[model samples]
Target: MPDESKLPISELQPDQIVQAAITSHQPWGITANLIAYESVGASLDVIRRGSEPGVKALAMNLPPVGTTIDLAIGALRSWHYEPWVWVDLTCP
Candidate 1:
């Protein structure tokens, strides 16, 4: 299997938010609110899966929501599977 840790950061680009409804697992029925950040903060709601193209593309796209003014607040306060792992979600 490919080493996820070795994946080059450059491979990930055009960052955007995706709303993924957890289909399975303990959090089934829950929604995964994902945020992709560049230098500034931007937010979008995922609407449907496979609507886009890419890893995060598997996640559905939704309406553009509030701009993440506070990184710490948005992340820490939101319900995430693993917030620490999310650090890479926004990183380049």
Candidate 2:
């Protein structure tokens, strides 16, 4: 990865904020996956994951994620699998 420590902050607009990767989260257990806005002192996030990349892409593109777009969040497991005989629900 690039040198995050040296990431620039000069281009930020008057009303905008810089996207950041939070390297610290002690008891909470959250990590670098979380993005933050240092100017606004808040973290950025999406409500839910879409079925495909398109819906998610559109959401970010409409307002843009900025130069730090390279830093994106994703799920560890995007899908699930089970044997056909398996059943999550059954008659008592």
Candidate 3:
């Protein structure tokens, strides 16, 4: 497997998905850790214990248009929150 952090857009192949993570975050006022599938799914690991992991997922429905994050990372692909390279790659 390729090192996700070091992987660049130029090295990405067609139809590939990458996994990215943030240790702690409060997206939309909810404190949690984020695991974006980058336009495929958005997995939110709740900060507090006892809460179901990924309580809210983008796979079910997409956020409204023009939302920078939404536009940057599509619904579900955000699994659904990693920074997918091919989705934004500028080929030479």
Candidate 4:
């Protein structure tokens, strides 16, 4: 399991942006939150804890934030919150 204490707080850069998703166990059951990453080394804080499942844990690499390169719930199940559908973040 990746340590949440080491999560990074640096702002994301243009090249870092990636199609990402955050999943957690909530009262309704396992849920996923889709998000966009702006950098390779960025941190996504857990704002609120779910009601039922109570968010027992979270897993993601996110550069300096964690050690593991990929987030996984167990031995097999893993989620890649990076390298999703690439898009232009420079245009207004």
| TM, every model | 0.18, 0.20, 0.22, 0.18
Q: Across residues 5-27, which tens digit of lDDT does each residue of candidate 2 receive?
A: 54232333333332334443333
TM-score of 4: 0.18
**What is the lDDT for 76 in model 4?**
17
Candidate 3, residues 1-92, lDDT tens digits: the string is: 64454433344344344333322234432211123332222333323221332233442343333232312221222123344422321111
Model 1, residue 90: what's the lDDT? Answer: 23
Residue clash pairs of candidate 4: 7-65, 8-65, 16-38, 16-39, 17-37, 17-38
**Per-residue lDDT of 15-69 in model 1, one digit per residue for the tens?**
3333222222221111233334122222222232223343243233221333222
lDDT of 4 at 46: 31
Cα-based RMSD of the predictions, in order? Answer: 12.6, 17.5, 13.5, 15.4
lDDT (Cα) of model 4:
0.29
Candidate 4's error at 27, in angstroms? 23
Work out how many backbone clashes candidate 4 has: 6
Q: Give the per-residue lDDT of model 4 (tens digit) for 1-92.
A: 64444323233334343333434433332333224332232223333322213232331212232122322221111136553322221101
Off by over 4 Å in 3: 1-5, 11-16, 29-55, 58-92
Q: By how many angstroms RMSD does model 1 differ from the true structure?
A: 12.6
Query: If both were scored by TM-score, which would come out higher, candidate 1 or candidate 3?
Result: 3
